[model samples]
Structures are given as C-alpha cells and as structure tokens.
Target: MGREFIEIFEEWALDYDKSVMGEHPQYVDVFANYDAILNQVVQQSLGTVLEFGVGTGNLSNKLLNAGHNVIGIEPSEAMRNIASRKLPSMTILDGDFINYPYISVQIETIASTYAFHHLSDIEKEIAIKKFASVLPRKGRIVFGDTMFKTEADKQLEIEKALDKGFTDLADDLNREYYPTLDIMKNAFEKHHFDVSFKQMNDFVWVITADKK
Candidate 1:
C-alpha cells in the first residue's frame, strides 16, 4: 500500500463511518446492498473468511454476527485498532493484502469493499494472484468498489470534480485507478476464477468470482 493511502485511512479511522455514510446519506442504501451481496457470497461456504481492508469492522461485524469466522488484513493501525475493538474475537491483522503473509487455512471466501481501489492497476493484478494462492480450490472472492469501464469514463468524473473546484480530489482521482470491468474479469480469469458482477450504482459495483 502507498504511504498516502495508508495515512488517509489512519486519519479517517475515527470518523470514517460517520463521514462516509453521513456525507452521503443516500449511500446507506448502497452499504445495505454491499452487506447483502457479501452475505450471499459467504453463505456459499462454511469455512473461515479473510476480508481485505476490513475498515472499522462494518462488514466484519455483520459476518461475525452471522456466525462466520473472519480474519481481516488492514494496513492502517488506527483503522485496525478500531476494528479489533469491535471484533475482539476476530483476527484483525496488520498488513495490506498485497503484502500480507499467507497461512494454510480453510479460507472459503475473501472479500473487500471500497478498499481495493487504493492499489494501482498492476498492484491489483498481483494482489489477485496472491488471493488465488491463499484460497482453497473453489474458494470465492467478493469485491465491491467504485469501478469504471474505461479511462475516458473516469476522466469525465474527474472533470466534474475539477468543475466543482475540488482540484486536490481531482488530482487524487487521476491517480486512483478504477478498473474497467473487462480488465478485472480478465485478471481474475487468468488466475482461474469464474467472474460475475452487478452494478449497485453508476459508481459502485459488486463482483463475485469463484475459483475454477
């Protein structure tokens, strides 16, 4: 993970949920959709789950309540600490998905939400390979995030940010890679995953890929 990305999450840890959900109250519906999607994927297996970037334990808490054992990989200590508090029984580790150590376990599902976008395009490709390596055969990956189908589409959104005088944010958007659906599908397929997805909105998407 990049230093800047980790730092942002560290600072946002305290107010992350409130700011993210409160700033865009309409997104409450979207989060509900995310939760539902994750639930569906997790229900397919009875083994443990590994959630990448388990920010503040939102989805982790839900999974725990649902009786699935979960282990989380989070780069930000502040965010990890908060998540650990909420899910004391859960193993919330301190590393990003790209570099986290692999262990032999019966991992049935790997899930991430709104966090994978922090990685660059190449990093995402490498990370998926790591995900494939750690998971058991037929293990599934459930990912949700802001993804675009093309650079031109993402550019249009950045242009809107500039028009609103959010230059800093526009600059950030310019660097934050949102994968085209085809790109994601190809990457996962190369690693033996059968991919499928649903767009929750213009910006948010939920992808389900089962190991083949």
Candidate 2:
C-alpha cells in the first residue's frame, strides 16, 4: 500500500490542482501536458472504469465526461473530499492500488494517473496480478505516470534535478518507487497483459496494458 505518503498528500491536496497546472516551478516537467495526459487515459478506457489513486478527481472527471461509469479509490481523505466535491453524485472510496473495493460489476478498464509510483516493485506486481484477476479479456490498465527507460536513465534524471537545484524533485525521485520500463513491462506481461509504453513528456509515460 502507498499509504506512507498520506500525510504528504493531505498537505498537497489544497495546492494539487495549481501544481498540475504548472504553477509550481519544480513540478512543471512532471506535469507537462496535464490535460492531454488525462485525455490519453480517458480515450483508452471502455465501459465501467475502476480508477486507483484518483487524486482530486481530475482523471475521474474526464472519465465521467466521456460517459464511463467511474469508481474512484483514493487513500487520503482530503483528496477524496476534493474529488467528491468535483463530482458530487459519484462515490470516491478510501482505498489504494493493492487494496480497493470492486462491487459486483463488469470493469472493462482500470486507469490511474501520476500516482502508481507510490507502490514498491513487489506491490506493483501484486497490484497487476490483482488487476489480471478482475479485468475481463480485452480489458485495459491505462496508467500515465513517471517511468524511466532504464535504471541509468533514472539516475541521470535525479542528477539533472539536483543540478537544477531542485533537491525536492531529486528527493522525490529517490524516495518513491519510480521504476524502469523493463520492470513495469515484466510485471504486466507476467500477469498476461499486453503492454505498450508512450512517453508523454520528459518525465511521464502512458502505459497501456490490455488483458490477453
């Protein structure tokens, strides 16, 4: 579970929308093309969507506007509240990637954005397996988050952030579970998902995994 960062999210909740809009200097690259990134995930989704880490409901709103029934799971109460305010009629539950409720309903696509890196590698593998168990054939896991092409590339990014005097960015890079593409690919493929990666910006990548 990525609940370790609940406190951080609680504090960041008020300013999250602004941060995503590129108001913050450090996170500009991290959230480049924010709307477009959410749109990409929205486009891939089908039928009912189970969204994990529904931070502030930005992606959730997109899904709902596209006419998909959206079930949101966010661990932070503050986040859940903001998302609820955004979409009042919808229910945004308290849960995470590895631990979330799925009512007796057909979930055709699972989606997340800017949040999966909170889970450790093992946790990610477990979450993917859980998705494999729940999603039907031709179902998808469309996630747009920060993923490095290689371990060396990840290190270079951290170093670049440090050189730019963005110690917080570097610290985030070191602290969280930002992994290489190879690792993510293995996790999904092992669980029988046909995965593809599309780099959205200098930082984020959209990973679309379809259940075989």
- Give one digit per residue, the lDDT tens place, for model 1 in 8-50: 7888799877755545443343344555555554554346888
The clash count for each model shown is: 0, 0
In candidate 2, what are the lDDT values of residues 18-87, reduced to their tens digit?
Answer: 9999998989999999999999999999899999999899999989999999988999999999999989
Clash pairs detected, candidate 2: none
lDDT of 2: 0.93
Deviation in Å, model 1, residue 143 alpha carbon: 0.6
* Backbone clashes in model 1, listed as residue pairs: none
Q: Model 2 Cα displacement at 190 (Å)?
A: 0.3
TM-score of each: 0.87, 0.98
Which model scores highest in lDDT? 2
